[model samples]
Target: MRITGIRATPVAVPYRSPEVWAFGRRRGQVSVLIEVDTDDGVTGLGEAAAYPSADIVLAVLRGLEPLVLGEDPFAVERLVRRIELVGTWHHVKATSPAIAAVEMACWDILGKVCGQPLVNLFGGRFRERVECFYYVARAEPDDVAAEARLATKAGFGTCYLKVGSDDPRTDIERVAALRDGAGPDARLRIDANEAWSPGTAVRLIRELERFDLELMEQPVSGRNLDEMAYVRGRVGVPILANEASWTRYDQLAVIKAGAADVLSVDNQMDGGLANLKRAAGLCEAAGLPVVKHSLGELGVALAAAVHVIASTPNFRYANQAYGALLADDVTSGFGGGLESYADGCMEVPSGPGLGVALDPDRVARYAELYRTEGASFSFGDPQALARAHALPKL
Candidate 1:
């Protein structure tokens, strides 16, 4: 069917706690949800992690309209190619989420038209449920320990924590507390978000290895593969690449450089769900496992990724999700809080398309919240912004 129109909504969903990383902190998730309407009466849902910013994502969507309006929603590949090459969005990686949203909506339309779930269309269920890690927001050691205990009680196999605090000793203490609370069996993953230098990474990782880290994520900058390789060689902890592997091209370079033990992939950062699957295959061929990364997403985006992850085999690690942090969701019974997860896994929606529908009332609530105070949910940390903190914090 031909595309009719597209509608975009910006929403801000509060987090149970602020998401802290090396560079900044966000109090909640700000996402742009798009609905693509078809002339034949089929509508598809897509969500973009307002990465960089919502204004940019909305502008990208507006720019993509002429290229998308009359196209066949089923021809996702063609549509995506047109948007990338002809629409000249290939160079601007920041605009990827918006393009991915449109492409995702098309896939949703395709699944609905075929009367099949996206997992089946992608390759059938290699797995019925996708496992996600509990994200323990960066906090005091005691708080981290408490959150870790809660994660373990909830049956999560893995717990993810952010490291790379200004003081190296503080990060070490927090990790120790996490291990103490999460116990011996829980896999603990830490992300530095490209905050450490190679030397610092090696030294810190050597010290932190006592906690039995599942992996150290982007401990050093992702820009230099040699730096990553150097740290990986010196450290006992396996490295999981994040910023280094945003696109399939970057994944290739990371593989060739022998920079990481695992690669992180994100459809929102790339172009679409299909591209995410492509990234997995690229890494799988290199004998590397893939973990799905998030820029903070809601249920609609989460479901879309789940279908692809469920259908793929090499998603051998617990993927990232905001379930542990999101206070509530705009969708029905999916991806809001820790309650939505059973044993740290979300069951793949068995319905057609993305298999999850929006809750209009909840959407309205969050949309209003975005309208009233969207800035509070942004990536900028006011305190961090006020202080002049240099990177690698040496």
Candidate 2:
């Protein structure tokens, strides 16, 4: 089918718990919704958690539309080579979120065309549902502990916490509270978001070892794989790289350096669903588990992730997509919210495409919000997002 038209609508989705994560101090998410329409009337949908800002995402998408129109949606490789946004847009770098949305829409159209779910393209389904973790954003120790309790109460297999602060001891207290409140059975993991120096990362990892964390994610900068490996060697916890590896080159660098025990994958950041699986395959060859990451994604993006995660073979760790944390979602065909874990696992969508459809009314509302309200996030200063009360050294 020939692509007839491509449309992008900007939206600023509000977060239910905006005050939690330091990276998301702003009260809302600014994203662009993408729709690709073909000559046969088959339409595809995708979500872009646009980086820098939604306006930039819209601008890039508009600029790239002319290149994709009248092209074959199924011809992904040819289409990718045609526009060639690599060095110019940083392919998997600065403009990934924008590139990702358009790419996801192409995959959606391909799935609809083939009359099969995207998971079928990956050699059929491995499992009906994938395990997911309950995400507890960074907050005070008591608040973190309370969220952990809620996660366990919902029968969550894991509780993922965002751990990184100006003070290492504060993170320790947060972990201690999470461990104590979540009980012995619930697994706990922390992501520093590259907030610590290599030396500080090692010291903090060593201190939190007693908590029996499942892993410490991206403790230091991803730019220095050697430093990451050094920290990995010194700590008992498994290290998973998030921001450290976005492209194939980055993943290869991490694998070659043995910087991490687990590799984190994001569909949008890694060039959509197909590329995400490629990254997963590379990690599997190296005997590493692939973990799905969430960064303020909406329902559409979460559905895209589920499709890839369901088809990925070497993914062992649970995924944490904070789609449910958003007050508004474009769709809800994923069965339950992010916290809704049935027996500590989430059911995959068996439907076509990403297994979800865009909610026209909700989409319209947010699209209108984007046009009128601009971006709703405060993303204020990272330090400003932290709690004023500080804990003493343990």
- Which candidate ranks first by TM-score, i.e. highest? 1
TM-score of each: 0.99, 0.92
Alpha carbon lDDT of each predicted model: 0.94, 0.77
lDDT of 2 by residue, 145-259 (tens): 8888877887787888877665677888999999987999888889887777788888889989999999899888888899899999999999989888777668889999999
After best superposition, candidate 1 residue 125: deviation in angstroms?
Answer: 0.5
On the 0 to 100 scale, the lDDT of residue 123 in model 2 is 66
Give one digit per residue, the lDDT tens place, for model 1 in 90-174.
9478999999999999999999999899999899999989999999999999999999999999999999999988789999999
Give candidate 1 regions above 4 Å deviation.
none
By lDDT, who's the top model here? Answer: 1
